[model samples]
Target: MKQQSGFTLIKVMLMSTMASVVVIGALKETVIQERLTGNFQKDMNARLLAEKGIFTAANNLQKIVSDNSSFSVDDLVNQHGLHVGNGEIGDDTVYKARLSKSAEGLLEITSLGQRYYGDANQQLVARFELKPADIKSPFQHAVTGCKGVNLSGSGVVDSYDSSKGPYSETNRDSSGHVNTVIGDSSVTITGNSPIKGDVKASGVIYLKGSSPIIGDVHSNTGVEISGGGGTSYRVEGNVYSGGFFTHRGGEVKGYVRAVGNVEMKWGSKIINANNDPYDIMYGGTGNFPASYHAQESVQLDDGTTRQNVSYSDAYFRKTPEIEPVKVYDPSSPDYDPAKPNKECDPFELPLNMPDVMEQNPERDQDFAVGATQTYMFTPKIGRLMTSQVGIKKAVALDSKKAEIYLFDNLSQSHGISDTTEERVFGMKNFKVYSDGKMTITGGDVIFLVDGDFVLDGNAKLTIKSGSSLTVFTTGKVILGASGQVITEKEGMTSSGIPSLNFFSSYSGRDGFQVKGASDMYATIYAPLTQVKLSGSGQLYGTVRGSIIDSSGGSGVHFDSALKDVNFGSGGGSDEKSQLIFKGWFFEPAKPLPDLETDEGETSNSDSGSTDD
Candidate 1:
């Protein structure tokens, strides 16, 4: 019995040892499975963090571009890396993003994510391309006046497509429209001047000339036509007026509609293109005489009679809806009182001069050249400042593209021969001058001036064939009689009108002036100034200003090609093109390196400390 009990104890001891071994093995397997699952979770978390970093960087870049902020790619490269963290991640996962330029010159962002308590990490890279944004241009009309427009002399208002050829009788079209935002007698056409296109005004339109208008006429107020010595000033298209229609001695070749009375005198007639009298719609009572030959006849002041004149009071019972013109008013919600020039039209001027000037770094040296010396400018020279500069010989640009900036106050005295002296009441007299010439031979060049830009005397600024010149100024612009802003290029048939452009921000009374015999083959845009063209010189491009006053046989030919041009937002608008997203990929895991913080301190990624 003792031997059997001893055997049972031995067996029980062996069984218990076996059970302990099995339990220990099972526990070890469970721990190993848990560790593998935990590691897998950490890897996924790191990958998600890396993806978040990419999105964050992309969003920030998009914002910068959309705001039109002045930023350089080098700035992002200098930042080394941008760190990101989340409150819900419990300080275990983080990401570091870096921006750089790829071999193809595209923008690339690389993100690396890590977990603090584990050895898990992930990397991702994305690419993008930069492009110019599309924005609406404000130069939609031949003449856009914030105040008014005055056309006199024998010069005509017409248009031609510069892309096809120069301004000729055959190439001309009736797209030369004139518009004004003012609400008085804002548009006047007198003398022998004729408008080949439409004329639209917010107020009264007065036409007194021998030449006829070949297009439609629209006014929110009244339409008055007075022929010069009964030479027959006619309108070949339809006429719509909100107020009275007065015709002294002229013919309307189309229908006439008015909200008020229609006054006809001295054999004024209304007929359609078929030589048949069209029915007139008038809201007020007017003289109507019956005749045997036709519907009606009216005897005028000159003892002449107009026959076949038909009138109907029921046609225009309600006033026609005319779209209101947007003008610069202080009470308007779009008006910004903080602007320096309050009279400048907000809708017309889209460039932000201050921001544009600040985008480029100022050159270390000043630009001062003697009258007899010639200066060769290249693209490497960048921007230079000068209180005043004189170029009696020539300031030539190299074959490579270049952009030169000249900043000056122009409140001091300068030694430029062709200058204009203006005397202020309480201030010292200042002379504004720009003499000599800047010739662009075989390159595209741009000159940005921060002060008054004047070209007087025999100054001749020439743009050669296959080259272009663009100028932007914030002060007065005067093109003297002998001065020439030419794009003809000796042998070519004038570099298309878009080759030369002048944009000004001057806001004074006579901010821009083009005198006699100046060969100006450039487009002038001075929306904040009073533009005075007093010469026989023909302008071959377009002109947009606050008020346009043309006299003395100065003719303006509009270039229809300007409608397709896209001028940038000048780095101050919230307009941008959509960012194109290139493909992204996961890179091999790598150890994180130390990065420089914005505060000029070194930060370690492995230390697990987040950037503030």
Candidate 2:
């Protein structure tokens, strides 16, 4: 009995030892599970923080697209990142973001989020992208006329990419592509000059003399080249015309295409840039060599057969596929403002000019002393005021102040012809600061003329550096033969300076100007006015009006720099500027090493300390 009792005791001791081991193992497993849960929670919190950073960046980007805001990611958030509250499962949670612009005008953004629970930490990252809405403008072209364009005499048209630097008559631009001349109607090139740009016209294109075109010339109507020496009249690029293309004597280095007849005179030739046979297209029937000169088989407008007809039979065939060039007329109900026009609509002003009434100026300021001297012409009733008078002080006019002249009714009795006495108003010598200096305050200084403005006598409008002048007239702007205007700013002799904007109302005397011997750089926008540049006048920048006429000695240079000028919000539907958003993305999340305790052990705490 004693032996049996001893065996039972041993069994009991062994069983108790096994039970203790199992309990110890269970406790260890619980601790490991808790640590794993803490780590998973921290990682998830970091990812959420990263997502929040992306959201914030998106909002800021939208703001920039809506308005002209700074494109800095740091500006959007505090140091390109924001600290939310405490992490869900960790401490010291924060997310940061950054912005960068690409050469293709793309906006890129990146964000990172991090969380810390004691010594353990986790991180996540993301990225996004954006683009500009509109980039169209009439200014992109060197010269664009709504009506027709006529290049006569020794007139020359060339191009300079201002993106390179200032343009000079001596140094041409580096943009391999030449300046472009687009006329909605006809484009007439005459004289022994040359055009260093592409020419496009919806109407007919008439080329005369030994004029050389460096770029392509395209017309919807016909292209007539009449001159001697095929080499003298050379086209470096292709030539396309919808109607009959009649070449008297010209050398085309590129393809020649015409919807109608292709009449090549004796010296005319066509070749590719490599001096090899090139392509040729003719929609209408015409005389042709038995064997074509094209590198490839000459294709007809029908897209079916090659030009394999005999010269004798190649007379009057028509191709129905070719369409005529559509001309742009503002009067057309389907007119598109985004499209170019041949002439400025008389009823519609240039989109550049702000529609502000001069009679009631938006910004009015009284002239300060030494800035201006007002002269009043208050004629007695029934009496004529006729006199050649003007102010030729050596005083330099202040651009901060305007010289406003008030006059009574400006009109002459219809029945009273001979009586210089019956003329109610007439100033023969109405001049302001003639032969004197004018100071531009870096801001716009307006000259408001209530009656007819005649820059007579030796009246010379001289401008100073960092200044701009604007002449707002309710009447006519007449410049006498002796009158002159010039600028001190180099490369800006006319009113083309950002400070000068000559605005004339449609109601005024048809915007008539007889300017001569003047070196002025200005953007004259008088759609109803007839602007004539005579007597060796050299004008730079853009000019738009009812009729633009220049003499042989006069010249007009279009400064490519004018494209950068903000001529007020553009007119028409397609003129307004805008922006747009592109898309978003998620980058692979980069994990950070887990923070550990001083003893190199992971901290798995139920409650973690928060980073203030």
RMSD of each: 10.7, 13.1
Tens digit per residue, CA lDDT, model 1, 288-390: 4332122345444567777643443232233444444433455567656565332334333434665544432322212332333323322222222222444
Model 1 ranges with Cα > 4 A deviation:
1-33, 69-88, 100-106, 127-131, 135-141, 159-177, 181-185, 191-202, 207-322, 331-486, 490-511, 525-529, 560-574, 580-587, 591-612
**Model 1 clashes, total count:** 0
**What tens digits encode model 2's per-residue C-alpha lDDT throughout 1-612?**
343558788889999999989988998898899889878876666666665655555564565544532233333333323323233443467555444454554555455566673333333333344333342223444444445556565645565533343445346632122221223467666665466777777778777777678788778778888855535437888788878788777677886778887776566666655632234567776654545354444445566655433322332243334444445456668778654343344223333223322333323322211113322211121111122345322222221211122101112112333433211221112244333222333322445444455655455555555455555544566665666665555333123334345555444334546556666666665555556556666655556554455446555556566555433223222322222446555666553223331233222222222231
The best candidate by lDDT is: 1
lDDT of each: 0.61, 0.49
